[model samples]
Target: MNFDYTLAFAKELDQADPLASLRKDFLFPKQNGEQFIYLCGNSLGLQPKAAREVLEQQMANWENLAVEGWFEGEDPWMFYHKELKSLMAPIVGASPLEVCPMNTLTVNLHLLMVSFYKPQPGRFKIIMEAGAFPSDQYAIESQVRFHGYDPKEAIIEVSPRAGEYTLHTEDIIAQIAEHGAEIALVLFGGVNYFTGQWFDMEAITKAGHAAGALVGFDLAHAAGNVPLKLHDWDIDFACWCSYKYQNAGPGGISGIFVHEKHFTDTSLNRFAGWWGYQEAQRFKMEKGFVPEAGADGWQVSCTQVMPMALYHASLKIFEKAGFMETLRIKSETLTAYLIFAVNQVNKELGFEQFKVITPTEAADRGAQVSIIAKDKGKEIFQQLVAHQVLGDWREPNVIRLSPVPLYNSFEDVFKTAELMLKISKEILI
Candidate 1:
């Protein structure tokens, strides 16, 4: 699929896009008077237009039904999460019973670790990627410390080879096997937040199991950005935040997946609460905690109505767009065009001013394209924003841009690269 770096070409592509109408479903941010070319969906997705309507409905329920809203409303708050499970399961490739929307990502990770991260005499270590998102690092560190083990010795970090920015699959597998003997769990992000590299989850899961360890993923960046098969992959557990690619609003509700195979395992420990108790007997205020069947058993508290409403709005859009596989087709082409446009910028300047650090293959990456600016990176990024080309900047010199298939058109990508080229020229001069 050859790509041209012309606005006319971009418009032509957008004109033929089947999902083009879906763009109107969101409200883009504005700087000055013009709408921004938002390429920061990897960091924070734009708000869905339906967000207001859904939120108001829930608010109205609170006004009209009062406390009885839990059971009396059209969409009862008591079983609200059940409505979401069917929508969310398709995003992560799981059955309805295998996924549940509950606590935030790290919070769910902590709960899952309590059940799966059982460190024993010979196996007390956890293996993970180096430079993981700080929350994961902190959570794993704290968990190891809580079990009376020093993090330095109990955690094994797999790093990229010298001078390389992304990890190789074989290297990751080797690390798992190398530490297999003492490893109790293997955890990794489905797609790295910094590099946008989509790790091979099935491969990792198989390796983790072969090494006699439970496997889990933090899919904060991967959910709705790429196609996942958590259930088919035989992953032990996984969790994700909905704010980014899922577009569920800032600090939106998070979800968890526990394989159906683990559903009846009574030996598994959990921080139990009334919300997770057997639904029929919950009103009886039973003595011992009896967890509900399936992934709902992992719930530590009752449903979050407002946040779930926000998430439902976005999931409906995904449903309208025909879910992840449909979106992935556009995302691959859109992301490829981004890489091409950035490469064109460097070619026109007769120097590699912007270096793309993400994997080139669509199979190994998602919508995000992280680039390292060779000169005046921060200045260039600031100017891009000032000019209404909104992308995000990381520490050091990386600028992250994500052309979300659901909202961002090809013209948005083209215009952003054009502004970046102009900014780079001005900064270098």
Candidate 2:
């Protein structure tokens, strides 16, 4: 794909984009009356324009129907999640029955672990990537400790080879096989949050199953940003937050996926609650819990109507743009263009000022491009933000910029690079 470092070229690409009109659906942030070229969807998505109306409607339901809101209204609170299930399933490539909108990411992870992370006498170890999100590290450590095993001894972290920032699929597979006999579970992020490397989920799932372990993922950065096939890939279970690429607002509702195969596994454990009771007999208030027949059974509390309303507004945007397949096509090209633009910046500056750490291969990454700016990295990042080319800066010297296909344009990418090059020249000279 030939690319030119010109604003006209970027506008030409934008004009040719099929999903261009979809950008109008979101509300971008403004700083001092200047609309930002938001490129931080990997951290938090921009708000959907419809979010307020949807939230108001739910608030009205609570006001008008009061207690009756549970069973009344166009979308009954009791079954609101069903509508979300239908919309969410296509994004992750799973049956509606296999996915459920429920608690936030780590909470769902903990609940799913109770069912899937069974530590047998000999098989008591958990294998995960070395630098997973901090919450995951805490959860896995506590889970191992709860089972009376030393975390240092029971947790196996697959690390990148020396001097490398990402894991190779073969290395990950070999580690799983090496620890196959004693491994109880294999958990990894769908995309590493720091480097934005999309893991080979299908290969990892196959390896985990062959190694006699249950596999799962923390998809905080992957869901809606990348195409996934959780069901077809034979993933036992997975969980994700919606605030990132899904544009579900800050701390939006998270969801879980449980393969239909696990629905009938009576040995599985769950921290049962009233909402999880079989719907038909829920009014009877039976003393014993008969879990709902599908992923809904995993629900511990009743519907979070307000958060779900916001999430529903965003899912509608996804449905309007079709599914992940279409979005992924644009994502690949958009991210590639960012990489190319950054390279162009280096060429113009006569040095590798911005070193991209994220994989350039489309299949191995999603929307994020993490770069390390030499010498004045933090200053460059601050300048980007000040100039409204909004991206996030991490500790030391990393900047994570994600060009989300839903709202970002090629012009945004071009201007970002243009500004970066100018900033570099000013700072270095």
Candidate 2 local lDDT, 1-429, one digit each (tens)? 898889999999999999999999999899999999999999999999999999999999999999999999899999999999999999999999999999899999999999999999999999999999999999999999999999999999999999989999999999999999999999999999999999999999999999999999999999999999999999999999999999888888999999999999999999999899998998898798999999999999999999999999999999999989999999999999999999999999988988999998899999999998877899989998999989999888999999999999999999999999999999997
Against the true structure, candidate 1 reaches a TM-score of: 0.99
Candidate 1 lDDT score at position 136 = 99
For model 1, the stretches where C-alpha displacement exceeds 4 angstroms are none
User: Tens-digit lDDT track for model 1 on 300-381?
Assistant: 8999999999999999999999999999999999999999999999987879999999999999999999999888899999
Worst 10 residues of 2 by lDDT: 372-381
TM for candidate 2 is 0.99
- Candidate 1 weakest lDDT stretch, 10 residues: 420-429
Per-residue lDDT, model 2, residue 351, is: 83
